[model samples]
Target: MIGNVPSDFRLPTSDSVIGRLADDVVLSIEDLWVEYQTPAGPMQAVRGATLEIRRGEAVALIGESGSGKTTLGLALLRLLTRTARVSRGRARFRIGDGRTLELFSLGGSDLRRFRWQECAMVFQAALNSLNPVLKVRDHFIETARAHGRKDDRQTSERARELLRMVQLDGERVLSSYPHELSGGMRQRVSIALSLLLEPQLIILDEPTTALDILTQRAIIDVIRSLRQRLNFTMMFISHDLSLAAELADRVATMYAGELVEVGKVRDVFYTPKHPYTVGLLNAVPPIAGEEFTPLTAIPGSPPDLLAMPSGCSFHPRCPYATELCVRQAPPLFAVGNGHQAACFHWERVTRRLDVWEGAVR
Candidate 1:
């Protein structure tokens, strides 16, 4: 069992609430834009990002470091710092009983209740997220109390169950401080804490960051197991394409704050239509290829968010760029079954499928 809830545990489920309708979608973001106020000017961190995460589906948002993957994740939970502002967007989240809540508009006690009870976010830095002074058990107690889980005995039992699920010894881990545990242990604790409230959706930002290869593999296994047992909706934000391929049901490629491609894991990896997505694939060495496959890095760096390039932000580095690409930004065009790419020369990408196929093999 995921969690042994108290007899009175319940989430708000009013049928009167209404928003944009989406069947089977747990979270739907439409035309979302986020900006950060800087010394130079406003930095466009996330731009016109629209995607739907269905119930119990794992969606990976993959991109380069500055491609706004983390920014978008933070925006969804309203966890952005004071410097950042969500300029415009509609993030409609499905609550129980066929009701949809506009996430961006929530405030005060409603927002507080929505955060841990409905959705949770595991931050990138696990060590920093945990308090140095607080013991592991205290962390669990505090989080549970904050979300109205008042029964200390029940809360501790739930925390222990979650910790065991993540492959940690509950009794031992509960007594230790954050500094006492290894990097992997801390990460596992964070994962366990995120599940303490039995959230319907969880957003993990680089959950395997700053860990050894062995530890990363362990973390991956733990995540896979948790998903199988609990079946919560997840949005995994990462620059690591290999890990994303292994964990995600769907892949959404982001470039300069815009979603360049969104499709099934197999479709996006094997037959990418966007040049940026293809470039990303070319850069990573395949896990199973026997022969030596030369890695081809995408030329140039990610554009400056303050003064973004004209038309398609990726046009400067695209191998198949045309005059039209420089003059007009391309909207996401349907390429295949549930596959979309924002590229005028997507057909060129299709012609070169053999190259990508060989790279992955």
Candidate 2:
């Protein structure tokens, strides 16, 4: 009896009410491997990694310090160090307007041109990323100018609009230099600059780690609001699982240099299959009253990248590890739709952990 549904309305998915669009993958990394020539020896930082960042979705890369999250992020922007090299794999980055390109094959000039227009990065450490000599206005102007927009008035207006988008005072922040602003303000400015070109994908590497609690919340809110307004995909990298869970639609857990698990945020946090992912969720401070008994922390430290362990890197720390975990590395196995984990004892651990109170259904 009902007529055609409204354009905005849609059928529900097994996951969310808004059904995922057709394969419109924006960024695709297949079998990626990045290695750095260290003083001791050549060390692999990212090993056999595969991920996809769809348009309009926010994905988080989370792990402990030295987990190679930053290194992998830098690889995406093709900003790796001199000694670091992408040994294998291809990262296919596509813009939202249906233009697809292979990032690995891009030349220096072509890559530079695509940086601000197709993709942008909000790097860690605002102190080093921004130019101390230039005013914030000039920084934004350079972004616009580099992308080939020559009008001064248009550039200024665009810069102000971007600043406003990140909830900063355009006139005041524009006039100030990077050294004059607080850490939070500097981060906000960096974010504003990243958005100057309205890039389809924004890669944030610990973008809020320098700010205080209040400022961190504000910055996160701005990111969420901007994503909703602009509908651009984000690849947010952070060590903070709680914040990542809040912002990202999907979460990927990295250990040493390998992706151990990746799945929906709720599934990873509430019903984590990977032992490393379980440890991370257990460490999050729960709200008062909703707290369970003192949670368990992983026993051992992460493996050294210079000499990664054979088989599973996390086998030393994983409690449910077996002989197979020590002798043979496990490939990512599907536990549910859109959920995968690299662990041998996932079944046994999921049953024994007592982490999830409810059944997955």
- On lDDT, the candidate that comes out on top is 1
Flag regions of model 1 displaced more than 4 Å: 1-16, 350-361
Deviation in angstroms for 245 in model 2? Answer: 1.3
Q: Give each model a TM-score.
A: 0.92, 0.89
The local lDDT score (0 to 100) that residue 314 gets in candidate 2 is 84
Per-residue error (Å), model 1, residue 147: 1.2
Which residue pairs show backbone clashes in model 2? none
Clashes of 1: 0
For residues 1-361, could you state the per-residue lDDT of candidate 1 as single tens digits? 1133334434333431455456699998999999999999898899999999999999999999989999999998889999999998778887644567788877766678678778899988999999999999999999999977789999899989999999999999999999999999999999999999888899999999789999999999999999999999999999999988999999999999999999999999999999999989888886685898777767778898988889999988877787999999999999999999999989878535344332321
Highest TM-score scorer: 1
Model 2: per-residue lDDT, tens digit, 262-356?
Answer: 99998888788898888877766667686475665566688888877778888777767668878989999998779999987777655234543
Candidate 2, residue 360: lDDT: 23
